[model samples]
Target: MADSADPSDTSKAGRAGERLAGAVKKAAGSVVGNDALRAEGELQSEKADATKEAQRAEAQAEQKREEAEAEARAEELRVERERLAAEDTRQEREERAEADRQTEAQRAEAETARKQESVSQATRAREQETRRDEVEAVRERGEAETRVRDEEARAEQARGAARTLEKVEEEQR
Candidate 1:
């Protein structure tokens, strides 16, 4: 691949180099009848493969997180659109009611009371919808955070395993 500034690209190139070097070492060891050198080369190639797999898994997790966040934002926008539509409807009703009150002065008090009740109901409904959206957003954020933590834990485990293998190789040497 052509050189790029992306870290993933760098990592991919590095891993490829490691595998190539490992193959060379393994071949040289074989020619010299050296078991230790061959073993080390095998370990190096395996480590490179493991790191590549881990990076792939992490990229997948990050994609999933981005997708989830996008979904949440879309939902919030939909809710906001609905709320605005509702507000417009409420405003239209209020305007019509006001016009009626001006013509029917005898029923003005009752109309005002009814309008108050209608406004209260709309307010309560809006509050409930707002609360529900907030809860959903919080839940989505928590899930995304959990996924990130899990990925981190997996990466750490891979590192630990690599370190343990290195220690064993040292002991063998």
Candidate 2:
């Protein structure tokens, strides 16, 4: 449902025509020296002028409204873009923090591994030292047992020579 009168055309031409007719009538009345006709024509012209002024005012107000609406829409878009940018910045920071945390965890794990390897190497060195000590002690014990057996054999030979000498002397006597 559209109105027959379009808003774009506010009938300024119609008001102009009325104003011309009133001017013509006023000039004819003045030539004839008719006071009433001249007065009526002047009033009509003034009325037409007032109507034109009112229409102009209305158009200006409508333009202002449209401009205000456009400005509001632009402001809304700007605010939305700013919010999205802030969210993007926050997300980027969170991602970086998470990456840093993961890197730190990896570093800690590597340090723990290094420490464990050092402890393992120390334990291995101690076991080797203990094994060497045990071997040396066994060798020393074997050497001591050999010296004791040699001394016992030498003592038994000396006792046998003494007994044989005593028997020879007794037989000679």
| Candidate with best lDDT | 1
Question: lDDT per residue, candidate 1, 9-126, as tens digits?
Answer: 5454476656655665565566568988878777876765676566556656665675576557656655655555566677775665555445555444455566557656756764
Top candidate (TM-score): 1
Taking the tens digit of each residue's C-alpha lDDT, what string does model 2 give over 58-103?
Answer: 7557556755765576566556555555666777856655665576
For each candidate in the order shown, give its overall lDDT on alpha carbons.
Answer: 0.61, 0.60
lDDT of 1 at 17: 57
Residue 114 Cα positional deviation in candidate 1, in Å, after optimal superposition: 50
State model 1's lDDT: 0.61
Give candidate 1 misplaced runs (Cα > 4 Å): 1-12, 90-173
Q: Where is model 1 poorest over a 10-residue stretch in terms of lDDT?
A: 1-10
The C-alpha stretches of model 2 lying farther than 4 A from their native spots are 1-13, 90-173
Instruction: For candidate 2, give the lDDT.
Output: 0.60
